[model samples]
Target: MNIRKTVARVAGVGAVATAALGLFSTGAANADTFIPLPGGEITQTLSDGTVVTIKLVGESANISGSMGATPVHRNAWVSASAQVQISGDTSATGGKIFPGYVVGCQVTIDGGNVNGGASGGVSWDNSGNATPSASANSGANLTLGPGQAKSFYVLDQEVPDDYGNESHKTRNKFTGNSGSVTWSDETIGLNGCAGYAQARSFVSVEVETDNVISWVTLWGQPFSLG
Candidate 1:
């Protein structure tokens, strides 16, 4: 009877262990490993004590591919929206605020014709010639490896009192009031790119009157592209 009891106890323990392993496997299979990015809100106080705030709304990406070439190339199109608000003691002197969206893209390829499995690169462009500084607007460029490429696109820009001139330097002006402006569905597209790619959205602001500039980037969840 003692031997029989011992045998029963061991069998029970084995059953429990098997059940626990099954549960663990099921949990692991059901768990999601992806993490989403956060929408961003940034505020900056100008030199003249003017408070400016920028907030990101919704952002997304659409990816496509072309099959004609020896090395398959992927295209990613990105879109985003944001709002900018200005307040605080603008009565002293009227100020102008330039607000716009910028999209930056980075791509990585494996054993492709581009980088030969080297690191990829990144690049940037602005729809409006607005820079963080008071000088001429200069875009950003980056080089990446492991078969990678990057580019930036400028989305819709709001110029408060734009007279529809050829000058790209247009922005929102606050004569003596507090207000906000929101943009929706600003889009940028990239083509003839290959490999895994991701895009980021940014809200660029320039306070012309106060000579202050700030940038708010929305690093929200990156979408996958073929």
Candidate 2:
């Protein structure tokens, strides 16, 4: 059997298998099967009764690999989106910074029988900033098994950026704007490395007001890579 084709086939099957096993079930009747990410909505209430909501609409991935020589290389392109809204009684006099939304993907690699592991992810934040920023992180010196398996992160709704930068501070005490924030077709890429790869998307929020710096993951899905 062609290792490349076989690996690719397994990657496709992995997405379906994950969904069939209820791993991708988000209690949404209209959940998508082709995308390897979570499909649904989430809502959270802040200390001041501010309601933060997020939703994952859809996601997709493209993955390929080459094993012609030693130290194979695999690359992937992942994309996803979400809808974010903040309403209810928001603070108007407190020094609170609301980071509205974040979109990105995570990858995990498991080399079958080789006892090897590597992981990484990339994401962008639309945290009330005019110009959003993107970032990525991964392990070093990765090695995979003969038939390793990888996972993709399709949608994670609640992720925080590295720091509570001024640009990411979407809402402040002065402008207690309560409305909708949407990120569409946001994309990130991963290159090099080998073994099986999987990816998914995520949405998140970082509240840096009242000494509360917390992040929450609202939605997520998984896909396969070569």
Candidate 3:
């Protein structure tokens, strides 16, 4: 009886392995690169009144100068536009929230001054009289269930150079007569926060793109109050 049982188990194991091989030989298969323990999406957009959820993943990011002198690195960033809706407080200022790269990942948002550049934002008031301000870098720590661990490096800071670049920092619009050109609301750690100006607000949303992994384990479905 013992011999029979041993042979049966061996045959079953061989058969299972063979089946797995056959499946892989098929044309295509859906596979995940990293499996989040009870995981899900990352990209999120939050405003004074609304919240938008976007599918996102960690991607390598960096910033360097024309001479390669200044270099700032970040784990990842939001690839493109994320949806947003104002919260209950219409006048409440907003800020960008970035889930830094891997918890252990060390990163930085160069925060260069591109205030006068073509791509930089126009101008705005910074006289402390209700000016629009916000930014996103890359990190955050979330608690799923009781003790369930999920941590991401995040970059969040008060806008020091609203419309300025590393080249020329500190340009106040409300207080100064510089036409209040326009503040670069997008706080990109890689560009040192250099970008063509656009919409002005206190809230910002960040996300990651291009996972490039063999497996991606999703957490739970997104939970939003919006």
Candidate 4:
């Protein structure tokens, strides 16, 4: 049947401390599995004495086993909030929040940070100051075979640029001491993978201060996409 789904977004309302699981459908044979995830947090101090903290909260997922009634098709809905905090006397000004996910088909994606890059399911840097890679897509719909994986951002905001031209952005820009972005019911439709699949969340932030500019990223626990 070639079932397809579209991604949805909603404005964030800060971080939520409590989360729980729920069901999607009442049918016994085709009911979706709801999972409440324990999101993650990270704190890093920049060389210029600026502090950056990133958090992923209120994460959950609803998974459908067979989207198109075929073994090669799967789909899921994910929700989460990405929050950033900047502090220090360096006059840390503003930053950008890039929230995304990596999906793997029959491949292990628990390798942690991949040389401080976000390519080929490698994840963010463990040192907390690696520059973010520019290899992420802006959509959630994806396709992969066994031993393959891909990463994509959650935001596709359209706005006017400096020249008044239409611009598409994948990251939320925030100014001041704190900023946050939230999304609900984002769709992830996969195809061509007949084996087990998995997905993990990531929050990458770019911090800019009067003295220096740096990046900090936080990775979430991986979960199945059955």
> Candidate 3: misplaced stretches above 4 Å?
1-84, 104-226
RMSD of 2: 15.0
In terms of lDDT, the poorest run of 10 residues in model 2 is: 12-21
Candidate 4 per-residue lDDT over residues 90-194, each given as its tens digit: 676777776677777777766553222335422433432223355544666666777777677777667899999998776778777888877777776777777
lDDT of each: 0.31, 0.32, 0.18, 0.62
> Which predicted model would earn the best lDDT?
4
Off by over 4 Å in 1: 1-38, 65-71, 90-149, 156-192, 210-221
lDDT of 2 by residue, 77-186 (tens): 34344445566675422222222211112323222111122222322233211111243221122233343322223223333557843332222222233322333333
So what's the TM-score on candidate 2? 0.42
Candidate with the larger TM-score of 1 and 4 = 4
After superposition, candidate 4 runs with Cα above 4 Å error = 1-29, 114-136
28-97 in candidate 3: lDDT tens per residue? 1122122121212332222222222322222111111212122222111121111222233233232222
TM-score of model 4 (CA atoms): 0.79
Best by TM-score: 4
Summing lDDT over every window of 10 consecutive residues in candidate 1, give the lowest-scoring window: 14-23
Winner on lDDT (2 vs 3) = 2
Give all TM-scores, in the order shown: 0.45, 0.42, 0.20, 0.79
Of 1 and 3, the candidate ranking higher by lDDT: 1
